[model samples]
Target: MFARRALLGLAAALALSTAAPAQTQAQTQAQAQAPNPRVRIETAEGPIVLELYADKAPKTVANYLKYVDRGLFDGASFYRASKPPGYAPNDYGVIQGGLQNDPKKVLPPVAHEPTTQTGIKHVSGVISMGRHAPGTAQADWFIVIGDQDYLDADPKDPKKTPGFAAFGKVVEGMDVAQTILGKPVDPKAGTGAMKGEMLVKPVRIVRVRRVQ
Candidate 1:
């Protein structure tokens, strides 16, 4: 009777071990399938839809959404389109947009969430914050037209090499980005590194809002 009872207990334990994972797996699947937040950027050129990765870059997403909610980006423009000289202009580079640090429209800067921490790289269609230092990123951001993994954090000295905070990607309207990138740029309009990258006539951001 003692051996029978021990075997019954062992069988019961085994049954629970198998049953628990099934339920856990269902919950995990449900969580994984939950959709991320999507935003639509209405531009004079066209519309650009973004899917933000709140799971990977919560703070960054929150910062961006704040601007969207307040309509701070409604009248902003895509002012800069950057690509290396001799490189194919239409195929590679980044397009930057925001209020351009309008004193009234800009908000306090958000903490940086580097790619090393978020696992969000600067790949084609990826959107990342633009900052002079890691923590200075505010409303200004950019979208990569091609893979620019060099923007990812350098693990060697992350403090000095912390990369841009990439929180989302262009899920639709990449053609609008490409079209903006191909627009005319002024040779002496911008300052410093941006000198030649400024669009002659900046593309107007008609509106920026959350997608349902």
Candidate 2:
């Protein structure tokens, strides 16, 4: 009957409409959830490789990747290395490095992801993105020179504003980081995070790439 044919045609049209939308949604999710691209930092001191964790902090890791894939850290020096003021050797330590004078490369601040939600910790050899303000963290990242678990989650927080979210850690060449740490920072040189003539010969990051 013509009525039956009409109903069948309507059903087919409805199915076509619904299926297309579902397929589009699946494609979008796939693009979003793909494994984070790997990044490696090669310093004149040595090469430090890191695997970014995009799943936990997609916005954060994605932000870092934007810098890495764009060659932002290359030719830049590890401008600041801070050891808790007066820590004999390597006590309270965390070394941060990134683009210094290069204005061509820089990213806008992303949301702050603390350890409480991401479950990421500031363990030794762990590399974390550094932010100027609470949510201003971006391309600049630091490597934990000591056990910095205090930077992790705070259970008391409901919003989980615990602290800086750690995305990845160093897999090799920590000695290079140590060497930079031992390079004698001046308090008045206005360089190497100091006030007057520091670094003598600044430690630089020559290149960065993705490793298997």
Candidate 3:
């Protein structure tokens, strides 16, 4: 009976030792998978808070944060607001902002991170980079006003049509984003692809800063 009791006690001790490691591992994993950093974009219209997905798009997030850290967006403005044409819903489009390829503010283009690779999408309130071609995105970015699956990378033909990189989303003040999207546009302010998309009165970005 003494030997049997000793064996039972040893087994219990071993079980606890094993369970403790498992619990610790789970806690470590949870910490590693925690949500990415967040920032506050204070615009003339209002403030928009964004949560950047660093795990999903590390390079893209890093590039964006670089500009944020340097105050590149301090005096930037939302120069364009594209809405759907007649017969289509007006609520579906994007509001673009950032350095706008200004020679002084533009940084070197970052590598493209397609949604296919990052697992992010250009859904409503999601923020994405604006580029003339793949891998040409620098400081310009846009905020989707509605579901925009077409902006997501095409899984079948990623080489030909690598869609825009989506790294973040508006966690608060999406209403401010929508309000900016509803602002008036100049009929003949832009040319070519941006012919009718240019905002008549651009919304100023007062400042951008990291937030807890």
Candidate 4:
């Protein structure tokens, strides 16, 4: 009886010893695979959901979330619908929105997170910061309606522009975004690159909030 008990105890110990490393490894994998944070933008046209790449662009994501948490983006509008000059209205473009430099709501500009550093790209539905120069991004941001690889950082860029800070992508309500893109633009509303791209009736952002 004693010999049988000893054999059983040894078998249990061996099993546990072999399982310990595998269990720890599984836990580590779970932590690494944890999902990124997401937010929903409630708009007059509809809701657009985005999954922020906090892991890739920590500063940009945190800055955006600050605007969301502070309700700064509430009642803001998608004021610009930019398309290539010759392209069809809804075929390819970006829709921009934010506090629009509201003196009371706009926060301090955050450091730019270039695509080169973040490993994010300006692909379809990607959301990126709007800035005149690097590190000047405040509350304004835009969502790409289609792939805009030109927006990605290029070492060979003669202008040496660091490209936009892309932090997230639209996860839902792209149709609503498209609809806004197709809306009317005042013939002479915007300035410079945004010329003729400002939506005549800006799409109101009802609210912005985090989601699981």
Candidate 5:
């Protein structure tokens, strides 16, 4: 009877040990699948709240958060609004902001997280990184004005062009986003890729912060 009792006790101990790890794994998976982080970007027009897809674009989200934490976007301006005439063929485009390659405000580039990999699309109100080339994105980002699936990675030939990294979307203040999109652009101000796209009076970014 003593031996049988000891065996039962040992079996119970083993069962507990096994259950502990399974419980921990279940908790970890639940945390991983939790709701993504949210942030509020206060601009002169209004406050645009964005919900970032940390699970899909972890690195991109982290990089953006770093800038927000450091107050890098304060006083920044939405300097470009790429619209119909400014960016022909692509009727609906984006409102570009952040450092704008200022060198003074630019942070080091983060690794590109292509839409093909993240499974995020560049739909209206979607926020995406702006880069001269893959792996060159730093502080610059854009908010899509309308359905812009062309910004997504071409599944047929993703190797040639990975497309932009879309990390989040405007949860509120899209009307403000459209207001910025309709702002006046300088006909003779910008050069090269930015020609005719530069805003004559860029909208100011008052501040950006994380919110519950």
Candidate 6:
């Protein structure tokens, strides 16, 4: 009788262990298949909707979600506007923003996700992260207002050359990013920035959160 009861308990436990993961997997699949999480970045000009591509770039998405979850991006401002050095300032338009208002929330760098691996193009209005001198990209990211082919990983030199990892595109807010790029700035002024401390206007990221 004891042996039979033990066997029955073991079988029940085993069945539960197996079923639990299956249920969890189904739940996860339901969430993953759900609509992509959307975030609206309210800027000085208008609001821009950014559809985060977590499925495509897991690391990048997870890193960005860390920022959002911590409320680090709220009330932050974009302070750097680099005109890509000599390209007529307007040609290579870019606006840098993220978790700058509060230095306390700047998280450490996560693993880098290269464009080649991500398969995401660096087209206009695509938002990406900027790494430190070497492999040290923190929470600092930028919005591309124009085609950024230079940002793509060099095919010939693959992993050697640093490539900007693109995690998401501005699905409904290209106009906002464009408005930011079009904002006038002193080309001769504001060279390389240690932080995003040179963005011309007070282009602020009002908030960064999942569209719940």
TM-score of each: 0.84, 0.74, 0.83, 0.83, 0.86, 0.78
Clashes of 1: 0
lDDT of each: 0.94, 0.74, 0.92, 0.91, 0.90, 0.76
Best by lDDT: 1
Model 4 global lDDT (CA atoms, 0 to 1): 0.91
Give the winner by TM-score: 4 or 6.
Answer: 4
Looking at candidate 1, what is the lDDT of residue 76?
A: 96
lDDT of 6 by residue, 1-212 (tens): 99999999999999999999999999999998987677877766688888888877888888888888888888887777666555654456778888653467777777877788888778887888888654567788888877878888777886677678888888887766666665666545554653333655668777877777
Steric clashes per prediction: 0, 9, 0, 0, 0, 2
> What stretches of model 3 exceed 4 Å from their correct place?
1-31, 87-90
lDDT-wise, the better of 2 and 3 is 3
Residue-level lDDT tens digits of model 1 in 1-212: 99999999999999999999999999999998888899999999999999999989999999999999999999899999997777777789999999888999899999999999999999999999999888999999999999998899987888888988999999999999999999889988899879899999999999999999
Give candidate 1's error at residue 70 in angstroms: 0.9
The model with the greater TM-score, 2 or 5, is 5
lDDT by residue (36-134, candidate 3, tens digit) is: 999999999999999999999999999999999999989999899989876133377999999878899888999999999999988999999999889
User: In model 2, what lDDT does residue 76 have?
Assistant: 75
| Ranked candidates, highest lDDT first | 1, 3, 4, 5, 6, 2
